[model samples]
Target: METLPLQDYNIYVGDFDQRLSDWLAEKVYSRLLIIVDQNTKMHCWPLLEPVVSAYQHSLIEIPAGEDHKHLETCQQIWQTMMEARADRRSLTIDLGGGVIGDMGGFCASTFKRGMDFVQMPTTLLSQVDASIGGKLGIDFMQVKNSIGVFRNPQAVYIDPRFLRTLSARELRSGFAEIIKHSLIADREQWEELRQISDLGKVDWPKLIVPSLRIKQRIVEIDPFERGLRKALNFGHTIGHAVEGHALETDAPLLHGEAIAVGMIAETYLSHRQLDLSAEALETITDFIRRIYEPVALDPATFPELLRLMSNDKKNESQAINFSLLPAAGSVEVNRTASPAEIVESLEYYNEIVAVGNRI
Candidate 1:
């Protein structure tokens, strides 16, 4: 029953059934396309069917997972829309997690130069972060979000009820984003999140709105990422590299998992560059380790990881740029990080986690 407006769209939070039904009762569209991954097709579609069943709709189901989020999948979405005879007035509803939201939004934005799209983000990662921001794209050349745009969706509908369908690992993955939001904007909230002993028992509906608002305020100020928006990419620079590496190697790393690793390394970097105290760094990194077990990284992968990071959209003049934490609740963007510093941070991360596991 809560509504927040973005540049060109409004985001509704709460029971999506009532909200979508009420909105659809008045809005008109030439056609409707519902895009989902295989996981959502099996788990979330039934919940959505009741509200959208009366419309002239079709389902475009792609294989679920980050690996499937690519240009080939986008082509399939475009082909399906073409077959459905969709036009400018048509609507595409993205009905799953980050990949579905990103790829579906990308597909809708590019179809016929742009068709209206709605985001009904199902996963915790999508609802609190990916679904709120207008950024949309697919991985290209094995780089995360290398191909995409900043097109807004027609609307975004978030229902925390969908969190029930996620596995424990998925829920933890999503919680990492909430932690990231708190770290970058609200230190108190970050402390509050750290106090929770069992992530599975979280009250997602209560927790989600604050996280949404944090990103909402930031996105409103820097919709095009000209300045402040990059602050939102706190863990994303290195996170994207880790994510891309995992996808390329067929290793298991959820977006949040990679970002958790990124946050750990970046937190170390914050201590070195931003004067974040060692005490604060240990507190934060310990909490991260408590939740995310480390991902094994080969020494050989550092070169490729560095190469992927160099391709980040935020970089300039080939110097790897980062949105680093000056302190909890404050971030400084466009900080230049040398290659040596980056490797040292990663090594620091490796040492801490390795030692933690031994204890």
Candidate 2:
């Protein structure tokens, strides 16, 4: 029954069955649509089916992976809702990870001028970061989140049971966000997290709350991402570029994985631009490099990645901007970086990997 109440909605965190059933029973809706990816259809839906079994509900499934997060996928959702005669009173239960939560929420937010939606995040990444925020949209034209809107859900349901089904790689991917949260907002949380040598055996229940709180506090101050919330994009500018390139090459990186790499590169930028100390940079980079494999950024791919970053929504007047750390738990937002500084940072990332290779 743990909860984080927002302006008009509440995020219920804990056991899902009773909370979901109790919440649904109280709402008056025309129909219920549970949107999921293929992975969740096989693993997560069964756990949730019994709770919503009595209600009028239908399932909309999409192919799994970040590569499928695009306009065509959203069209299918709109078509399904239209054929089903879903109205403003209809509720969408986004029952998977970040992709499902984001794409489903985007669809619900836009369909028939909007409908009520709920988030039942079934991945560590979603549970801790993506699901709580109102940001909803899909990648467009090879750019990450290029066509999204900010729209809060009716409610968000988070239960850690879903983490049990995730693979080791998925778990590690999600941990990158947890690490990012700590680095940007909570020094003590960063201290607690850095001690862990094994991700699989880490205490998730304890780890998740602090990360969720960091994001919630920021979102509360700037739900529309005008200023304070931009700090939450700490690694996303470069991360999104790396992600877009990965997707274009047909070797899509998970959102968190790409961000992990982005954080390392941006940490270098932070040192050069924000004057973050070398010691702090090393500590941060070492931890992240241990968790994620370096994306092979051919010097040739730098232009494409740079092009992707230039298109980031955070930028203005064609200047490349970043949300960078001056130190752990401290961020400076909307700071501009020159192309030379960016290429240097990428080279620094490559140097780190090359050094690791020699070891």
Assess each prediction's global lDDT (C-alpha) against the native: 0.88, 0.88
lDDT of 1 by residue, 1-359 (tens): 78876767888888888878888888998889999887898889999988999999999999888888899999999999999999999999999999999999999999999998999999999998886668899988887787899888878888877888999888888998899999999988998998987987788877888888899889888888889888888888888898888876757689899999899889889989987888888988899888987765777899999999999878877899888887877788888788899998889889888977887
- How close is every model to the real structure, measured as TM-score? 0.97, 0.98
Q: Give each prediction's root-mean-square deviation over alpha carbons.
A: 1.1, 1.1
